[model samples]
Target: MIAEENFSSCETPFLSISSRAILPHIHMLMKQAIPCFINYIHSENYKKKNLNEDDLTQIYIEQAQILIRKHNYPFNVNGQYRDITNLSKGFSDFYFFPNELGVSTNSIYSVESKRLPAPDKFREKEYVIGNNKNGGIERYKNQIHGKGLNECGLIGFVEKHNFKYWLDLINSWIEDLALSNRNWNEEERLLEIESHVDFCFLHSKAKREEKDIELHHFWIELGNGNSISNSKK
Candidate 1:
């Protein structure tokens, strides 16, 4: 079985206590990764209380650690990226619900993430593999990137290298789809999966022109609604 321990059980880690120090620099990072992020808000527990940007950032960071523990991927939680105009060196903009499976302990929650196309760039942005920023897995230094799953047993994707910005696209799709009158449940979950993959391909291609662009990739595993690993990444 695909268990969290299979990835994160380790002596050294991709992220350490020192990684927490990167929190102060996240504000600028969020801007570049998700231009619309400032307008969006998330609930602290979804049912408990409303959250501001600070609360959301903290949650993103905390859950990232849990996700790392579950996925056991090698990423410097405090790693930096340069020459990206919209993002900070080590910041992740908005992490979606499905992208946050590691944090949800309740069995009731479904896993999912969403992405939306930019309004002005929609035409130029091909949500296709060949034309979009995602040049495919073979082009990246890390193979498993921008892959996320949802609560309704659906899996979505983004490019691993450009995950921070791509997350914005995913959130936009989720928000729009959730608010639409269309019955998402009626369609096969595979439809959504295919849509996600397409979006990743297109978004990756669109951003390829950016000078010195980079993304911090995150992978989340939700097993029966709980994280399976004891060791935190």
Candidate 2:
């Protein structure tokens, strides 16, 4: 059993999807919440400050907890959650712990967040593939994360440029890697689902070891507006 703690019972509107049978339902729900969180942070109307990856992750958790409690959702969002199944693999940025009735499970949906254009110039490729091979995509490709799960996610905090700009750049980088890296292929490029002025969502599939790992990519802009319009695609 995955740990069940800190959650209190509450009345909520029923959502149709079953927790154990449908992982995609959880994925969709989580994706839907991104714009909400983006708006949640912006709604505060505080003086704009440059927030790092961790800051954004924390904000996401806070917003998710609100929904979990309000809706009685079985899953929980955890930051820096370790994979107890693999003690040495290290913690993921966001672990959507799959649970039943608020009880945790071994099946974890891990997501690693990255900053587009990286905070430093020297680490420019860190969004697609990192210098130390810890790039958002590289981690799963190298078995650094999601070794057991067939799917994982990545979030790009677009500190610079638009979503299309980074998407093309990242796909180009992946195509370049496919030339020499046997594990990489052109098929791993992110394909767009939808986008707006403030957020973009895409999906990609990558080869990990002998199996295929699906990747869901979300990038949120933190530029001039920092808020999404016509929300929730």
When summed lDDT is taken over every stretch of 10 residues in candidate 2, the lowest stretch is 224-233
Residue-pair clashes per prediction, in order, are: 25, 1
For model 1, residues 40-116, the per-residue Cα lDDT tens digits are 22223242344332343444445545544565433313211121332222222233221132432111111112111
TM-score of each: 0.24, 0.81
* Model 2 lDDT per residue over 1-233, tens place: 99987556544434445543556666666766777777766664622544566777777777776777777666767778677776536568877765455344554678888877677777878877877777888888876788777778888877668898998999999999999888789999999998988788899998776688888887877664443222111
lDDT of candidate model 2 versus the reference: 0.73
| Worst ten in a row by lDDT for model 1 | 185-194
TM-score of 2: 0.81
